[model samples]
Target: MKLLVVFALTLAYASASVLHGFNSLEDDTNVGIIHGHNAAPGQFPYQVQLISPEGLQCGGSLISHRWILTAASCTEHFDNVTVHLGSIRRSAPRVTYIVSKKDIIIHEDFNRYTVSADISLIRIPYVKYSIHIKAVKLPKIKRSYPSYDGCNANITGWGRTSFDSTHEPEILQYAKVGIISIKDCKKKFGKLGKYIWPSLICASIVSAETWEGDTGIPLVELRSSVQIGISSVDSPKPELEYPAIFTRVTSYLKWIKRHTKLPL
Candidate 1:
């Protein structure tokens, strides 16, 4: 299937705000990055834009030549996925691949209600590595949970740039954020804090906020250049000062390796 321009639509939970959504590409209702600057070419070679047949958009990361890592919520209800790669500009990807539903591997224990186990993988044809396209590194395999508190990270996507904006940026946008302790994050979320399990990470934006369409994107730790989280959810009320939530990658390393058969 050919890539089509689509806008943003929110896929929120019962009483909480989520960052994933569906929107028309031609309309300005749900458009660009929230307070983030345009990303430089090849700055995030592993980044990919995922589009559902219904025009729902999310982000993913290339973990191997044939495997993509993303949010389970992004693939849970969408199929015939269209993935754009090797470019910072959404309209000018170096290559685009159409993946079937059978190729998607979502965490079986995923719970949409709590956004738990919210990670998934997509299988695509083997792609050669290039300056514009490369796989991201996963955290080292370990039996214990990894801690990333206070680490600086970079988040990129083509999601809405502002809470009240009606346009999504055609070019990829990114913001720097700092990983915060789950304790602090839970305190900030109040009742929503119950969902902030150990497998989920919380981050506060150092600059721009992450909004709709930014879900499923990668959160790379700046120091190690390793992808540690997947954008999962955020508060709808920009004024609440809630932390952006991510599905912790290290917690699922074995799960990803089992499905992708990669030495992650």
Candidate 2:
């Protein structure tokens, strides 16, 4: 699959380009994984590093014994993928799982232009249970306990340290973000506002950095510990404090259930 994915500032960029402060380059593709403080090992047991022969490409979450959740843009053209789990440090993974291209599933209605339904799932088939790595708790379908509006959440990944930097961090990094309404996000996004769909989730970070390679990372609700969103877009500004977009997890419940037999 030649996934022609690009977004932010100019739609001509590649998968996760540096937003805000830098000029768009030809070779810089991947989502944002910037500005967050380092996370302790096992702090996020559900987190996984999506890797190809080129090294760390994206971040994902362990959703079930045999399933991993991430962005469709990340899995594109990748036939041989290795998932690193049970560790916060990607350089020294405790457990690694392999998956073929046939096992990958991208949302059928996904729009590469608007990045709608940007979610994807990787079928592991046989994941051994362990304390170091586990499935994340999902929010109930009709539950309103965790309000999507202005809720506190987190984003973690091993993306770039800065927009100009080319290296991915060895240790995982995380930052706190607040869920913002689509209306507010639209106002902040300006010309790019029209592309914000109802199916997507919007969030704001005051001073945190989330850049390329951070795509597909989970946005866990602080109070409920349930993953409500997946990292999708970073603001196209240099400040890196603009509202970021996420693929709403609650919107894809049926699609997720259809692929995995988990009681989700």
Q: List per-candidate RMSD values in Å.
A: 6.9, 4.9
Best by lDDT: 1
Candidate 2: tens digits of C-alpha lDDT, residues 115-227: 67888999986777677888998866664433389788888888785666767877888877778898887787666678778778877755454676777889998888899
TM-score of each: 0.88, 0.86
In terms of lDDT, model 2 sits at 0.73
Each model's lDDT: 0.77, 0.73
TM-score of candidate 1 relative to the true fold: 0.88
Off by over 4 Å in 2: 1-12, 16-33, 143-147, 239-241
Candidate 1 overall Cα lDDT vs. reference?
Answer: 0.77
Candidate 1 segments whose C-alpha is farther than 4 A from its true place: 1-17, 20-31
Q: What is candidate 1's lDDT per residue for 1-264, written digit by digit as tens?
A: 001111012224421125521222222332465556778898899999998887778888999999999888788876578999999999899989999999999899886665578898999999999999999988878767558999899888888865567556888988788899999888986765666688888887545556667778899999999999998864544546677788999888889989988875
